[model samples]
Target: MNEDLTHLTREELIAEVVKLRKGIRAHRDSTMHELCWHHPQLWNLLPEKTIPEIAVPAWPQFIRGCLRYRESLDTQLPDAPRVKKEFNDPDSPSNI
Candidate 1:
């Protein structure tokens, strides 16, 4: 991952910085629901192309994990505004 950048022109170095900033901005602007999904596009921005093996928890365990995460958010950002809008996932069977 430690590629020597000495060969790159000033313009090239600036272009790299610009590209990195754009990727960071995209991640920073993700919504609450969007944050729940995996972001391979963001990972692709890095020099490493290899995908790391991901371990998924079972449904019951995953739900418990989600609950704990939500609880942590409540503790961390207690003053954050709550959204009452229902999340309608168009592709979900329940929505159908």
Candidate 2:
């Protein structure tokens, strides 16, 4: 991986961030789908609410918690795992 972002202009960096956010949303959607598929009873328990209503509200806090956990790990080991592109393919069997 090219560990250099210095070459990217500010606009380019912002664009990359947007792209990453989209990928994250897609991954989250796929995971939620798999969860619902595996646990139909859980879906029934929340019959009145759509999936977004059930999950979207918690996304921000969940992301913050993840960042905090990663930051703590990074303090111990400077070379922490960066978010790489994974789980974006909706047709993957693991996603289903």
Candidate 3:
């Protein structure tokens, strides 16, 4: 992506950045939903205004820090556990 970006003119890069920012903002709701699913309590602590005011600015740095920490650990993290749902039981409405 960086190599591709290098080919873009300054105006094109600015336009791409604007488009990417808008795309990120548009997906914010889904991102928040995923965050709530993983950590409901932490999600609740993040005020609505904090996203635009703080999270956006801090996100890149935070992610970089996380990546550096993960690299330092020198261990592969296990995959997240999956929850199975029984949607087709004999007594379920769909079976009925």
Candidate 4:
């Protein structure tokens, strides 16, 4: 699915840029839960069909990684507004 950029008209190039920007913005705006899910659709933006093998950590390590990610946000966006937890129930499958 390689696109020949050489053949694209000025308008076509602009349209492609706009399309890619929208996709990038959507990924940028994703929340915590969305971040944990696989994003094949985002990968589809490229011209490849191959999927790389993913390595998932064990539960304890995974939770620790999540905690570190939150800690990083504190450092990176210290003054950012906070959102109330949407998945706080301990027994819930979607708890974050």
Candidate 5:
């Protein structure tokens, strides 16, 4: 699959995200669970607010693969440090 992520317009980006969500759902159905389960990190690839819907049905192996792909992205964000921190401050949005 191609991973070229050009700057998409708002509508196009939303459409892309919707399509990806569909694909993730479909993938959850088509493959065995282990394909996504091995790596616990895959859950982090998705938006924190909406991840459960997309990930709940997916196999652990597939989730692991998804996480591997997410981490392997060309410009992915850094993983958080060992300690967990709250991010409810208005000034610092979670996206950053």
Candidate 6:
């Protein structure tokens, strides 16, 4: 019987996961780095922290999001007419 897995099935994979998690908990002191990997505080955009340690590029990501939004804009509305509006300035009509 494998000790790591709570259930009896697939013991080897579970052991690997448990080992990895234990290592992270025991030796990793960089929780903020992990958090910042997925969540940018925006304060890190400054000169001291212009680029994050991770390979993610901010501008390219922003552009990709814009492109996706633009593509979704052209999509036809439903019979009830689902209106797409720019919430940034609610008063103005949305192009999408």
Top model by TM-score, which number? 1
lDDT to native, each model: 0.77, 0.54, 0.50, 0.77, 0.51, 0.49
Query: Can you write out model 4's per-residue Cα lDDT over 35-80, one digit (the tens) per residue?
Result: 6667777776765677878899999999999899888989998986
Clashing residue pairs found in predicted model 6? none
Q: Write one digit per residue (lDDT tens) for candidate 2, span 1-96.
A: 344567889998898777766655654555322422334343433325455444443888877876786577679767633443345565555421
Preferred candidate (lDDT higher): 1 or 6: 1
* Clashing residue pairs, backbone N/CA/C < 3 A, model 1: none
Misplaced by over 4 Å in model 1 are 88-96
lDDT for model 4 comes to 0.77
Better of 1 and 6 by TM-score: 1
Error of 4 at 38 (Å): 3.7
Model 1 scores worst on lDDT over the 10 consecutive residues at: 87-96
Candidate 6: segments with Cα more than 4 A from true spot: 1-56, 69-84, 94-96
Candidate 5 residue lDDT tens string, 1-96: 223346667887788788777767755653222333443344544434343434353588766977777566434535532222233455543342
Shift in Å, residue 22, candidate 3? 0.8
Instruction: After the best TM-score superposition of candidate 3, give how far the Cα of residue 93 lies from its true spot, in angstroms.
Output: 23
TM for candidate 5 is: 0.27
Model 3: residues with Cα > 4 Å off, grouped in runs: 30-96
